[model samples]
Target: MESLSCSLFSYPVSKCSSFTRLSRGIVFASRSDSKKHHHKKPHLPKNLRHRRRTELPPDFHPVLHPVPCEGPPSESDSAALPRDYDENDVNDSYDGNVVWESDEIEAISSLFQGRVPQKPGKSSRERPLPLPLPHKIRPLGFPTPKNIIRTHLACSARQPISNQIYKNPAFLISLARDIRSLPPEDNVSKVLDQWSRFLRKGSLSLTVRELGHMGLPDRALHVFCWIQNEPHLFPDDRVLASTVEVLARAHELKMPFDLDKFISLASRSVYEAMVKGFIKGGNLKLAWRLLSAATEGKRMLDPSVYAKLILEIGKNPDKRTLVLPLLEELAKRDDLKLTQQDCTAIMKVCTKLGKFDILEALYNWFKKSGSVPSVVMYTTLIQSRYLENKYRDAMAVVWEMESSNCLLDLPAYRVLIKLFVALNDVSRTGRYFSKLKESGFTPTYDIYRDVIGIYMASGRLAKCKEIRREAEMAGYKVG
Candidate 1:
């Protein structure tokens, strides 16, 4: 029990306490569970505890229990066991040596039978294998900055105009009051030129907002125009929003003032945006008025501006008349260029309005603009020739389409079938009808009825019956 001989016997301990000698002179230390210890040795169960110099019987065997909070997760599959293993699991495999609890065995059995076992501290079931996800789950990332309500709140949380009193308030208030006093006929442009005082962009925006609250949008427009017209001042997005809001509140969506008078202000892009806004707002009349004004003022607006306007207006049959006026105005410009998309829109509008004569002139413009008419355009042109009793001209357009290697669309096929039928050309009609079927286009009831009439009039009953069956199959009962 004296100090243990260092070489003879050594055991890890905080202090070198007394050691007891066992039957074979093996030493064992009384370890103290002290605060100074960095790592505590693991505690083992009684049957698996360390034995000092004990001899075991010939058939004696031991099983090890899993120590918690150590190592990777337990494998559910027997095939995943480490080292030499078998069905009996009597070898040194991970599963064979470790003693499993009753609950763990049942859990693993249920897992193999497709019962998802909820893991400790995990809300979801731990899959036996790393299988694919049930479906693509969208990740809930951090709160997006572009959210509508949050952005609105953030904008509203900015320093308001009343709180802007400390940031040069006197000039903004005086300028707002001065603009408020002006007559409806007068604008800030007339008065701002008299003073050479430096003006901030925020000051101008504030004045417009103040005028908006005063219920005098005419006064607001005056402030906006002065800022827009002045080469030195920038009419930023905030200024534009305030002015438009004020004018909208005053029910002046259709501008009371001539839009072209300010077309030369600051940038052409500004007025182009305003024109597009008019079109988007469904004010075709106002949009057309602006186009006419831009034309008269010799301000060349973006072709896309009117192109978009024309395309939108042409969508409604009732608005087809509006398309012709825009085209005519655009025609006045010899240097004007239009895309094939816009020309296709024009052809549609022209076909609806029965403006057959204008197609020839449009072709000349297309050639001059270096844009080829699309297949839809050629279809409309051929239909134009057909309606005008110009069969040869329609055939000429067909030849042009073939030369352009344009594949026959549904409308084109129907037109060809009718065109040949109009001339008592049964062979071509049959050819087109067969091609239309090969193209996987379900013939319309009208086209089927027309083709059947052609085959019937020519005493071709078999072809007529086949087309009738096909029509019925297409969910159309052809007479």
Candidate 2:
């Protein structure tokens, strides 16, 4: 085994065998060296090399020993640094002093040091600021002078200046005219801005009227409050009139104009405004209040306006109570010229409200005025009587129609026939039936049938047959 070992060690190694032999030698060396080095100190890299002294007294060792560290070398030990490193080192030192401070403090320090930090080039925060105040804003492409601004602001602050003289109104009117003159796409925003400024400064009434013309009454109302609060600038009567007309025209358009403020105007124009506004708003109570005011003021209330109010109330069957006083008021008007239409309106209201006293008053008024009661008037009264089952009174009305030379129209004859049949007065029904035939008028088939049925039901079959034969002979069918 010893001879074999010597031969193996003495053999010259091939290129491939050299690698294998070297690896085996390293393994043996490590195993042998581990045991010897177990009692020795570890060595470090040459750059970090230090001297070692073994013969040290009992408690005496180097005063300072180097330790493995992660950061740059201390200033005292930086002898190996490059010549250019000092400049960078100075800069780094300065940065280190600033980095720990807040940005505001650093900026203030920089300012005090007369080294204004170059402002960042157009960052979002450094971009041009918006106009600090609304009045300072000018239209794009329109440079406003400070003097012009002061003049405009002074003009705006005047309490009583007519809006007509204001630049904003003039500007808006001109812009709008220009827009209207130009094609649609040219500077619409400019026109709108001018209009906004105009509205801000213009008369409330005019603004409201213009907005109403544009079908924007709510916007008009918004502007109106501003005008109203500035009592130094009283709106002209024409402006108030135009506003009221607009309100009446766009009755359904909601407005924020306070009705109380309008009513407080108390002028003729304001009274007119209140009347029209209430009518437009469909508030009959307010309309009536205006009417009462007109009467108290002795101002002539237009009959057409009164007619509209009464008719509107009568049309709603639930609002019958509102009709009576209006009719009575009309009846009591001595200076008022009551036309046939007015009489007709009164009769209709009386019919709806069951106000026979008003009806009687209307009849007396018509007779005293030498106006003939229409066939409709008589028929309505007859029908009312029939509804009340006052057959005698309804018959009297029929007689009065004939006596008054008023032709008994179809409705009149129908009511009479129903009333007589309801009263079981077959003889009177026969008399009216004969009158209808002799007058060259054929009664409605329903009326004729109703008469025949009444006779038949009363066991007067012969009379029924007789009436049927007579009706057939008069070009009437007996069904």
Candidate 3:
């Protein structure tokens, strides 16, 4: 076995050293020989390395030896160290340097509160037992040497609750397991009370977010209620966002989760999960209710939510009528800048409701925003004018659309067909009607009626009957 030795050297120890000083001349000796030791003076802390040693007091001892490491003692150069201070070796352990207060012990003891075994003497199987340390300090599942326990204590009692919860993986794991095992109807406060020692604003929010990821909407909602009742932890925007995520995950969004509370705090991933859940449930009224809560400044939602709205509207075109209230609410928020798509949706609603003034206002708003009006916007305006019997203005919008050189969409083609039919211009009406079919624009029931009416008025029963048959083949119930 390799041998150990010591060499006495007097050096000034820093006042800030954690371990208590034994003697001024105490210095540790190396166990192995290598040139690397010559390069480094010793393992002195950075602050102490460049400091010069101070003069020893007149009464200072000439030599003192370092306490040896824990192992069998091999050969040692005894002549290098003095034997006079051997009695001081008993105080060398690192635990003796600092003291733990009563409050700290109580804080640590709270971690294993109910899990500690109450009665130690009576056990059915006691074959493999541990050494008897004091019951207060012996944590459950402790297997390390007793000397290392102070490190654990220092780690636990030294931090605030917010940081402590994040550091203890065992604590977080136990918390998740306990919450998962709870029944949906049982009070979440019970589980929360069990771990009340570690509760904080950050911990509560983290639990809710994790529950959302685990898909536990019921428990998440319950714990969120507890957060509100607890007076110490002030629930902020981050906390509100996490709670919203839990409900949105299960497609259980409602008024309690006011998303406008933190319009920017929640992430897109949460909204994506919400949109998917809504699509799977085959209902959008719940989603619309939640979105409608968004006030003036927060009028815009995540793009993913709007994309899903478009997808759902495509699958069930009649649902467009359901968005009328939300559209009107958004249109009233003058400060809210809207996209072309938003303009189109609002105009469609305005036309259906015969709100000609609102439609004209929306068109003027978009025009003032420095963006050229889209083909659909102009088309909605033309149809609105024609509905109000403003033939002069309707024809004027057609002239402007042609001057803008914008490609006509399906709505523009239908408006032209209706306008020409109203003017008793059969030739122009037939031209636009053929283009509608060739462009794969499925005509609505109203479009078919207008076309058949114009044909019958001009003495063409053969053409009217053929158009009626086409409408029936396309699944429209003609009267």
Candidate 4:
């Protein structure tokens, strides 16, 4: 039987190369003889054959037949395969084992009960929802105790209420003088709280001013250190000014207040505040020191503040000594805006200092720039030259003033009369005297006195008598 089976498989294997030709012949041949011939021949090597033939029973041909060789099926046949099939029914008699095997695999996979393990790096926990942020708390819009303290300090320093409200001892002795006088409906607690906070801030100025008005300058000094050590809530000009005034008053009250420290604090204020404070305190030296520090440290002062300082200093007889040097320093700064007031102040300072050389340079600078000097500026220059005994230069400035149509007022005439009289130039003095009268400005007794002195000093008795008569005619009570 094995021999028969081997022969059956061997015949096909040996003729496999000629199967195409044999297939054509078999189609014409009788079926019985073809079957008998197909059962012959087993002479091929065993090792080259398929193992399935050896495992099967000899008689079990398993309906061995060649599948029709029409090649691969068309798309329409492939499309007819069922996508979903029952695994239990796949092995039914009509269907092949091949279909059963594929369907069983899909059914087994669909019945998977356990979850797959997560990837090595990932977590199963879903991302938690983000938490909302808390809202920010806003500050109160109303003024704080600090604001009231600052405002009260600023106002007190600027205009001391003590001097105006509680100047007398009776008002000072009454503890509730102003407090009791306030309307009953007023917020006394708020007012008291503000005052208490102001006191606690250790502002010596406000304390001193308040106490001084209450005739308690002694108690004011007792808390001077507290005021000195208190942290400045607002270190602006107004605050600094208050601090300075407080310290200055403390010093006046016989307290050992540090003048240098006070001046240093004053230096930090605006230039106007520092200058005015020093001037008011009659400390011109400290004013100059603060001015120098301000200019050197801040690099520039406000033009208006600088002008105010210059004007204030120029008007003071003692402080005027510092003007020329200050003006020179001011002129060196290119950023300084030289207004008419500044120019006039500089010219006046130069005249006072007899710095006619600088004045000439300034006048030429103004003229070349085509800027017409105002009456004050021209008069300042003329007065300055006259003070320097430069009669010709002084007269030249007067001519310039007249040409520019800058009216020479009484002050200008007084300056000219004084200048000419100083030079003992009788002819020039007489000429200016006639012009002064023509301008409808009668000479004062001082001017007449100056004219008479100039003529008498030159031994011109007749000219002196004529000046006396003119003085009498001009309503001067000449002795």
Clashing pairs in 3: none
User: Could you say which candidate leads in lDDT?
Assistant: 1
List RMSD in Å for every model shown.
Answer: 19.8, 30.9, 28.0, 24.6
Better of 3 and 4 by lDDT: 3
- Per-residue CA lDDT of model 3 for 244-361, tens digit only, reads 6567657687534655654455454444445555544565765665465543445455543543554355445567665555555555554666678866766776677677897888
Over all chains combined, what TM-score does candidate 4 have?
A: 0.41
Cand. 1 TM to true fold: 0.47
lDDT tens string, model 2, 1-479?
Answer: 00111112232222111111222222000111222323333332332233243322221121321122346555644433333333232222212112111333333434433434444466565567675876556455755566543226454676434353343444434433444444634433443443344343333454455566566554444444444544444455655565665665567434436744544545766566656666766777767776875666556765657777787788888777776666666766776666777667766777767776677666667778888878888887777777666778878877888898987766777877888889888888888888877887777778878899999989988888988897798789887
lDDT of 1 by residue, 217-292 (tens): 7777867777776665674766786676566545576564645456655366556656765666577777787788
Q: Between candidates 1 and 2, which one is better according to lDDT?
A: 1
TM-score of each: 0.47, 0.39, 0.37, 0.41
Residue 349 alpha-carbon offset, candidate 3, angstroms: 3.2
| Candidate 4 residue-wise lDDT, 89-141, digit = tens | 21221122111123233334333422332345677788997775544345547
Model 4 misplacement above 4 A = 1-272, 295-298, 303-325, 364-371, 418-435, 438-440, 449-467, 470-479
